[model samples]
Target: MAEAMPQTLLHEALQKHRAGDLVGAAPLYQQVLKLSPRHPDALHLLGFLLHQAGQSAEGLKLVNAAVATAPLHTDFRGNQARILLHLGREAEADKAFRAALIATPANPDALRDLAITRRDSGQVVAAAKLHARLLCLTPADPATLLAHSGNLIDLGRHDAASALLRKCLLLAPALIEAANSFAFLQITIRDLDLARDWFRRTLAAQPLYAAPHSGLAEVCFFENDLEACLRHSERALELTPDDPQIHVRHGFRLLAAGHVREGWQEFEWRLKRADRIRREGLPPRWQGEPLAGKRILVCAEEGVGDELLYASMIPDLIAAGASVVIECAPRLLSVFRRSFPGCAVHAYKREGDRFRPVHRYDWLPKDPPVDYAIDAGSLPSILRPDVASYAHQRPYLTADAERVAQMRDRLAALPPGPKLGFCWRSKEVAPFRNLYYTGLSDWRSLLTDPAIQVVSMQYGRGWREEIAAAQKAFGARLHVLEGVDMTDDFEDILALGVAVDAIVCPSTTLVWVGAGLGRPVMEFGVEPHFELMGTGKHPGFPTVRVFTRSLAQSWEAVTGAITDAVRTL
Candidate 1:
C-alpha cells in the first residue's frame, strides 16, 4: 500500500511536470520522496525543476543524489552531467558524460554534449572526432553537420568545412549559421563577389542578424567601395554597438575616405582589441595639448612599415614643446635615434626578461615619470587631421650621411644606366593582399630592359632564387648591391634610395623609406592604402607617385605601365 501510494504520487508529479506546472509538481515530488525516500524519478524530476527555476547549486546536489540512487540509469547520468555543465564544472561534467556513454554506447545526447565540452576546453581534435561520430550516427542532422564544419574550419581544413556547410545548406536552406559560415569561407579565399552574394542572401532571410552586415562591410572594404563599406559598418554598429571589429573597420573606412575626426575616434577602439599589445602601468594617454615641459612616451605599435609611417608625426609632436621619449623596434632604434637626436630613443623592452629597462624621462634622472604615453599610430589623428593639414610634409627622416656617401660611391661603380630600385612583393602575404604582390616572373618585361639597371630592394629570404631565376629567364643584368644587407640594413637602404635614380616597388616599407628620404618613388599596388586615399598621392611624402592596378587589369598591366614610366624617366 505504501509503495502503491508513492507510485501514484510519482505518476501525478510526472504528469504535472510534463504539463509545465513545475510549481504544482514540486510538492508532489517531495511527497513521493517522503513516502519512498529512494525514489530516483522523484529526485531527478525535482532536481531538474529546481535547476530550471535557477536554483542550480541545490539542484545539482539533488541530481547527483538521484544518479547515485539509480546508478545504471544513462538518462539520469546525462542529466547530472548537464546540471554540472550548467554550473561551469566542466571537468566533472565531462566525467559524468563519459560514464553515461559507458552505460549506453552511441548515446547521441551524451556524445553531442561531450563534443561541445571538448571544443570549449580547447581539446579540438578530440571534439572533432566525437562530432564525426555523431555525424555517422545521425547523418542527416544539420546541427551536428554545422558543429563538425566549425571544427574543420578551426583546423584550417576549409575545403572540408565548406563541403559540410554546403550539405547543411542543402538540407536546410534557411540555416543562417551554415550560410554565414559559407560566406566566411568565401571571404577567406578572397572570393569577394561570392561572399557578397551569400551575405546579401543571409541579410534578406534574417534582417535583424548583425553578423551578415559586418561580413558585407568587409566585402565592400576589400572591393574599395568606401561609402558602401561605411554604410554597412555603421548599420552593423547600430545592430551591435559593442563589437570591436566593426568599430575598427568603420574607423579604417572613415580614415580611407578622409573623414579624420570620427575616424580617429573609432580607430581608438583598436586599443581594446586582443591582438594589440596593451601597455600596462602607463600614465594617461595624451590628447593633443600644449606640453611646454611635459615628458611624453610614444610607444611603437604594429609593424616596421607602420612605425616608419607613423614616425613622420614625431617631428610635429616635438614642435609642440614636449620632451619626447620613443620606444621602438630594435631594428629602428638606430635610425630613429639618428633622425630625432633631441628625443631619447630606446628599443622596446623584450617581454619575459628578468631585467627590465629603467624607463625614466630624459630630463628627470631620478624619477621614472612622464606626463603622458601614447601609441605612435595615434599621432596622425591629432597632427594631420585632414589632407590639407599635411602641408608641412617633406622628408622628415634622413639616412646616415656616411652610409649615403658609401652607397652613392658603390652605385657609381656599377655599369652606367638609369638606376631603378624595385621590390616585387611584400613580406607579408594573405589571400586578400596577394593582389598587391607582383611575381618576379611577371616583371620580365621590366627586367629585360637593357637601359634600366634594376636594383633588388625586396628584403627577407628567398629573394636570391627569384632574382637569379629572373636574371637567367630574362637574360638581363639586374644589380644587387652585394655588400649592402637589404634585410636588416635600413640606414644603408635609405642611402641606396639616394644612390638610385628612381625607386619603383609595390607597397612595402622600402617605398616608404624611399619616399621619406625625398627620393622619387613610384608605388605600385592594387589598392591604395589609407594615406593615399584622397589625392592618390601620399599625404606625408610628395615624392611618392602611386601607380595602382586598374580593376580590369592584373600586375602584368601594372608592370607594363611601370616599364613605360621607367623608360620615360
Candidate 2:
C-alpha cells in the first residue's frame, strides 16, 4: 500500500510534468517520495526536473537513488543514461545506456539517445550503424533520416547521403535540412550549377536557413565573382557574426582577390579558432605605439612563396623604424638576409637563441605594440615596389655557381635547339587552383615537332607515369634532366629561368618568377583563370603570355597555343 501510494502520486506528478507545469510537478513528486522512500518513478522524475532547472548536484543524487531502487527498470535506467549524456559524463553514460538496452531490447528512444551520445563522442561509424538500426524501427522519421545522412556525409559517403536526402524530401517535401544537405553534396561533386539551383530551392523553402547562404557564397568564390561573393559572405556574417569559419572564409576570399587592408583586418579572427595559434610561448603584443626603436619578431606560418612575398615587407618594417627579427624557413635565410640587410634574420628551425621574449609579430596583430603587422602579401601594397624595383633585383635569386655551371655543362651535352621547361601540375590541392594544371598531351604537340627541345623540370613525386609517357612519346625531343637538384622552389624557378628559352607551365609562383626575370612564359589554362593571369597587361610578369581554353574545348586547344608560342620562339 505504501509503495502503491508513491506510484499513484508519481502518475499525477508525471501528468503535471507533461503539461509543462514543472512548478506543480515538483512538490507532488517530493510528497510521493516522502510516502514511499524507495519509489524510483517519483525519485527519477523529481531528479530530472531538478537537473533541468540547473540543480545538478541535488538532481544527480536523486537520480542515483532512483537507479539504485529500480535497478531492473529500463525506463528509469535509460532516463539516467540520458541525464549522464547531457552532462557529458560519457563513460558512465555509455554503461548506463548499454544496461538499459539489455533491460529492454526494443527501446527506440534508448537506441536513438545512445546513437546521439556515440556520435558526440566521435565513435562515428558505431553511431552511424546505430542510427541505421533506429531508422529501421522508426521508418519515415525525418529526424532519424537526417541524422543518418549527417553521418554518411561525415564519412565521405556523399552519394549515400544524397540518396537518403532524396528519400527524406520525397517523404516531406518541405524538409529544408535534407535539401541543404543534398545541395552541399552537389557542390562536393563539382556540379556548381546544379548545386546553385538546389541552394535556391532550399532558400525558397526556408529563408531563415543560414547554412545554404555559405554554400551560395562558396559558389560565388569558386566562380571568381568577387562582388557576389562579398554580398553573400556579408549576409552570412550578418546572420552568424560569431562563427569563426565565416570570418576566415571571407578574409581568405578578400585576400585572394587582393583587398589587403580590409582583408587583413578581418583575417585576425583566425586566432579565435583556438586559444592560441601555435603552442609556442609567443603571445600577441598589442601595445599600440610607434614602431621606431621597438624590437619585433616576425614568425613564419605558411609556404615558401608566402614567406618570400611577405619578406618584401622587411624594408617597410625597417622604414617604420623597428628593429625587426624575422623568424623564417632555413632554406630562405640567405634570401631574406640579402633582401633585408637592415633586419635580423633567424631560421624557424633553429633552437640556439633561447632567451628573447621581447615582442611577437604575426600576420594578424590583435594588440600590436609597434605601428604595424603585415603578412608577406600585404607588404606589397604598403611598400608599392614597382616593376623596376623587382627588376633591379633581376638576378634577385642566385644558385650555387658550381651547380649552375654543372647544370649548364650537363645541358650542353644534349642536342639542343630551343630549350623549353615543363611544370605540368601545381602542388596546390584546391580544385580551383589545381584545375589550371597544364595537360601532358599539350606538351606532346610541341615536342612532336622536332624544332623544340623540352626538359622535365617538374617537381613532386607521383609524376612517374607522366614522365614515362612523355619519354616514350617524345624520345630525343624530351630531355628529362638528372642530377639538377631541384631542392627549393626558389632554386627551381632560377634554374628554369636561366636554363630555358621559354618556360611552359600552369599558373604558379614560377610563372611570376620567370616573367619577373623576363623569360618568355606561356601559361596554358582554362578561361576564367585567364583573367586571373594578373591585373595589368601582366601585373606580375611582363613576359607571360596567357593561353586560355575557349568554351567546351579540352586542353588540346591550350596545347595548340603552346605549340604556336614555341614556333614563334
Tens-digit lDDT track of model 1 for 457-494: 87887888888887787775678888887878788788
Candidate 2 residue-wise lDDT at 438: 58
* TM-score of candidate 2 to 2 decimals: 0.66
On TM-score, the candidate that comes out on top is: 1
lDDT of each: 0.81, 0.68
lDDT assessment of candidate 2 = 0.68
Q: Tell me the TM-score of each prediction against the true structure.
A: 0.74, 0.66
**Which residue segments of model 1 deviate by more than 4 Å?**
1-172, 184-192, 221-225, 349-368, 468-477, 482-484
Q: Give the per-residue lDDT of model 2 (tens digit) for 1-569.
A: 86577778888999999998989999999898778777777788899899888886678788889889988788778778877877878889988988888887678888898898877666678889989989889978988999999888767676778888988989988888888888877766567788889889989987766778888987776676767977888888888898777887777666546564456556667656532224244544423356777766666645565565455445556667787777777767775665566767766643312111122333323343333333344344334434333332232334445555666676677775777887788754432344566546556777677767777667666665776776686642567776554446455446556767878877665665565446788887654442232242444345778787632356887788778878887
User: Looking at model 2, which ten-residue stretch has the lowest summed lDDT?
Assistant: 351-360
Backbone collision tally, model 1: 0
